[model samples]
Target: MSKQVVFTIKLEPELRDTFMAEAAADDQPAAQVMRELMRGYIEQRRQAREYDAYLRRKVEVARADKTAGRGFSNEDIEAEFSAARDELGQVV
Candidate 1:
């Protein structure tokens, strides 16, 4: 393992007791469970950042398209939806 860093976490008595009981039931220390949870949390955060960047790029590309300036009127949007629904046999 890498160098160790000690840190303190303050938990209410009731929560602390519950955590210890669950940890013992699983036959693993709470610290190990916390590490696993931290790993998953970090992964999700990284994914969210990547998706945000992708969405920003997609929006920039969409704005540069001439068709986007046509900015569908309500009637245009409804007509397109009606055509799609008719093709798909959907209840419009």
Candidate 2:
């Protein structure tokens, strides 16, 4: 088991009632619902940041490839794939 910390947040009465009702409809305690929501929010934000970093790395690689004159044109890619398909006796 991990150590847990006590945290609290203030919500408007109406909003809190609504949240509790939704949690009850789902057969979950309101605290559990809030925990799940918090975890999902954190996961989504983390994934967004990771995706942004991945895009940055991909752009850097593309720029380096361009600088080194190592990239292919659309025609070049199509031709290469066509040749590979022919070699493998596969239909396009």
lDDT of 2: 0.90
> Model 2, stretches more than 4 Å misplaced?
1-3, 72-92
Q: Which stretches of candidate 1 lie over 4 Å from their true place?
A: 66-92
Candidate 1, 1-92: lDDT as tens digits:
56389757898999989988998899999888788888999999999999999999988877766366845677888999999989889653
Q: C-alpha displacement of 13 in model 2, angstroms?
A: 1.9
Displacement of residue 2 (Cα, Å) in model 2 is 5.5
Model 2 C-alpha lDDT per residue in residues 1-92, reported as the tens digit of each score: 35398777898999999999999999999878878888999999999999999999999999999899999989999999999989888653
| Strongest candidate by TM-score | 1
Considering summed lDDT, which 10 consecutive residues are worst modelled in model 2?
Answer: 1-10
TM-score of each: 0.69, 0.67
